[model samples]
Target: MGSDRTPIFLCAALLLLLVVGLFIPNWLVFLFTISMAKGLVVLGLILLMRTGLVSFGQGLYYCLGGYIVGISGQHWGITDVALVFLLVVLAATLLSSILGLLLCRYREIFFAMLTMAFSMILYGILVKSEKLGSTDGFIIAQATLFGWQPEVEASGTWIFALAVIITLVALLVMHLYFRSPMGFGGEAIRENEIRVEYLGVSPRRLIYIKYVVAAVLAAFGGAITAVAAGHVDPEMAFWATSGEFVFIALLGGTLHVAAPLVGAFLIEIIRTIALDLAPYTWQMILGGSLLLIIFFLPKGLWSLLPKRREEEGL
Candidate 1:
C-alpha cells in the first residue's frame, strides 16, 4: 500500500513545483532552477553516501558538463540543446568509466582525496588554458529547443521548465535504482563488504557502477546550470563547490531520494537570506546553521517528516 502511494506523492510534488514555477517571480524561478541543478549533483552524492562513500570531486564532472556546453556553443558551433546534453553525458560517462577503474579500488579517505585530486587537476588545466578563458571562464550561448529560440522574457521560464522536467525524471529513475538489487548491494557493501563478497556480489564492481552513475548525474546538473546562468567557469569544479554539494547531501540525508532536492532548496534560500542580512558574516551564519542541524537533526532535515500511521503502529 505504501509503495503504491509513492508514485502518487511524487507526481503531486512535481505538479506543485510546476505551479510554483508558473507563479513565482523571475528571479525566484531562476534561483529555483539553479537549486534544482545543484540538487542533481547532491542526488549523486547521496548515492555515493548510501554505499558508505563520499566524493569530494563531483565538481570534476559538473565542471566538465558546463564547459562542454559553453565550449561547444562558442567553438564548435553546436547550438542544438538536445545534442549538447547528449554529448555532455557521453563525455562524462567515458571519463568517469576510465577513472572509476582506478578509484573503485580504494575506500574512505583515499577515495575522497583521489576524487578531489582529479577535480583540482582539471581546475589547474582550465586555469592555465587561456583559450578556454582561463580562470574567468566564458559565457554560454542561448540555447534553442526544437529549433525555437525563446524570447528574452520567456527564456527563464523555459529553462525553469526544462530544469523541472530533468529533475523529476532523474528523481523517478533514481527512486527505481534505490529499490533495485544493485542498490541493495550498496547498503550491504556499506554494512559489510566482506559479507557481500561472500554472498557472491563484487563490492568493487558495484562501487564502480555507482560512481559512473553519480558522475553522469553531476554532469547533467552542470549542463543545466550552464544553460540557466548563461555562463560556465572553472569555479564550478573548485573544491569549495564540491564541498557545497557534500554539505547539501549531509543536510538532506540519504533516507529518501527527494531529500537532496529539498535540502538544496533550503540551503540556497538560506544563503540568499544570509547574504542579504549579513554579507560579511554570511559564511559564519551558514556554518552555524549546519552545526545546529548536525547537533539536533543528525539524520538530516528529511527525518523530520512524520512517520506513516503504519510505521507508528497506529
Candidate 2:
C-alpha cells in the first residue's frame, strides 16, 4: 500500500500545482491548460496503446467534438459550459459506437490506415463546407457559467480548472479500470488474443468498449479546446494533428498514467521553442528528435529514467 501511494502523491501534487497556477499571472498557465486538455486526448490514446493498438483516426472524434461545441454554442445559442460538455460526450459516444463497429475488426497497420482515411475525410468535409464556417471557423460567444460570469480575467484560469478536473477524473477512472478484472483481461488481449479467447473472454467486445472510452475522452479534450480557443478549424482533424498526439504518447514513454501528460507538456514546450527559434526548420528538428527518441529510447523518455520503473512498476 505504501508503494502504491507514490503515484497518488504525485497526482495530488500535480493538481495542487495546477490550482496554484490559477493565481499566477503568467500566460504560460494558458499553455499548461492547453497541454492538459490535449493530454486528455492522449490519455485516450494511452488506453489503445496499452491494448497494443494504435489509432490515427482519433482526430475524427476530436474534430467532431470541436464542431459539436462550435455549432451548438454559436449556431444554436447554447452557452452553458456544462451543457456543451454533455453534448460533446454524447456526440462522441455515438460517433465512436458507429466507428468502433468497423475499427474493432481490423488490426495493425490496417487499423491505423483506416483511421487516417476517416480523419482525412472529416477534414475534407469541414474544409469544403461553408455553412459549417468552412476554413474560417466561427468564434465562440462568451460561455455562461449557470447564467453567471466566471470572471473575465480568469477565463484562462477557468479553462485550466476544467482541464485539471477532467484530467483528474479521467485518471481516477483509468486507475480503477487498471485495477479491475477487465484490466487483466485487456492485458491478456494485448499480449495474446488467442489465449484470451481460449479463456472465454470476448476480445472484440472488450476492445469495442475501450474504443468508445478512448473516443469519449478524446472528444472531451477537443470540446474543451474549442471552448478555450473560442474557435474551431478543420486543421484540428488533420493528419499532422493526429501525429502530434502520437508523438506526445511516445515522448512520455507511455509506461504509466502520467506519461501522456508529461509528454504533452514537453512537446508543447519544445514546439513553442522550435517555432520561435527556427520556423522553417522546426519540423526538421521535431522529426529528428522523434527519430532519435525512437532509435535510442524505443520505449520512450520514461524508460531512460531509472526512477519510475524500479519503484512504480510502470
Candidate 3:
C-alpha cells in the first residue's frame, strides 16, 4: 500500500488544484485548461522528437481536429461531446495516416520541410474558406457531457476535467506504447535506421506508425483546445503555431512525460503575465526568455532540476 500511494497522492493533489481552481471564480481555471491543451500537442511533438523526427507540421492535424469538431457540431447538428471527440479521433487518425505515408519517406530537414508544407497548405485553404468562416473562424455552440447539461459557467471546469482525463489516458497509452515492441522498434529506428534495418525491422514502417500516432495525439489536443477556446481559425494550422508546439516541447525537454505539460503551463503563465504587465514588449520578453533558455540550457528546464539533484547527490 505504501508503495502504491504515489499515484493516489498525485491524484489527490490534482483534485485539490481543481477544487481550488473552481473556487477562484475567474479565468485561472480556463487559463490552466488552455495550457493543458497546448501541452498535449507539445507532448506529442516531444514523442516524435524522441524518435529523432522533428515534425514541423503538427499543426495540420491540430487544425484538422479543431475544424472537424467545430464544423460538425456547428453545421451537422451534432452536439454530443463524446461523439464529437470520437469523430475527431477517427478523422485525425485517417488524415494523419494518409499524410504520414508520404511524409515518413523523408528524413531530417526534408521531413521537416515536407510537414511544414502540408501544414501551410492547410492554413491557406482555411484562410480562403468562406464557408468555414475564413480568418474570422467559427464559434462552437455548446457541448454536452453525456446526459448532463454542464452550465456555461462550468465550461472551464468541465474542459479542465476533460484535459486532465485526456492527459492521463494519453500518458498511459504512450507509456505502454513506448514499452511495447513496436515502440522499441521505433526508438531503435530513431537511433539508427540502418541498424534497425539490419535487424529485420522496417524503419519506414516504424517511422510511419510513429508519425501517425503523433498526428492522432496532436489532433486530439487540437479538438479539445477548440472546444475550450470556443473557436477555431486558420491560424491553428499555421507554421508559426506548429513552431509554438515545438518550442514548448524543447522548453520542457523530451526526457519525461510531464515535461511538456509543465512547459506548457509555465510558458502560458509567463505569456499571460507578460502580456498583462508589458503589453508593448511581450513578444520581445517571451522571445528573449526562449533564447536564453536555448542558449543556457539546451535540454530545457527539466534538465536544471535533474542537474541540481545530481549536484546535491555528489
Q: Which candidate wins on TM-score?
A: 1
Model 1, backbone clash pairs (residues 3+ apart or across chains), number: 0
**Per-residue alpha-carbon lDDT of candidate 1 for residues 24-77, written as tens digits (9 for 90 to 100):** 899899889999999999999999999999999999999999999999999998
Candidate 1 or 3, higher lDDT? Answer: 1
Worst 10 residues of 2 by lDDT: 305-314
Q: Cα deviation of 81 in candidate 2 (Å)?
A: 1.0
Candidate 1: residue 86 lDDT (0-100): 93
Q: TM-score for all predictions?
A: 0.96, 0.93, 0.91
Please provide, for model 2 over 195-251, each residue's C-alpha lDDT reduced to its tens digit, 9 standing for 90 to 100: 998999889998899889999998988888887888899998999889888888888
The parts of candidate 2 lying over 4 Å away from their true place are 1-3, 305-314
Clashing pairs in 2: none
lDDT of 3 at 171: 66
Worst 10 residues of 1 by lDDT: 305-314
TM-score of candidate 1 on Cα atoms, chains taken together: 0.96
Which model, 1 or 2, shows the larger lDDT?
Answer: 1
Output the TM-score of candidate 3: 0.91
Clashing pairs in 3: none
Assess the local accuracy of residue 175 in candidate 2 as a C-alpha lDDT between 0 and 100.
65
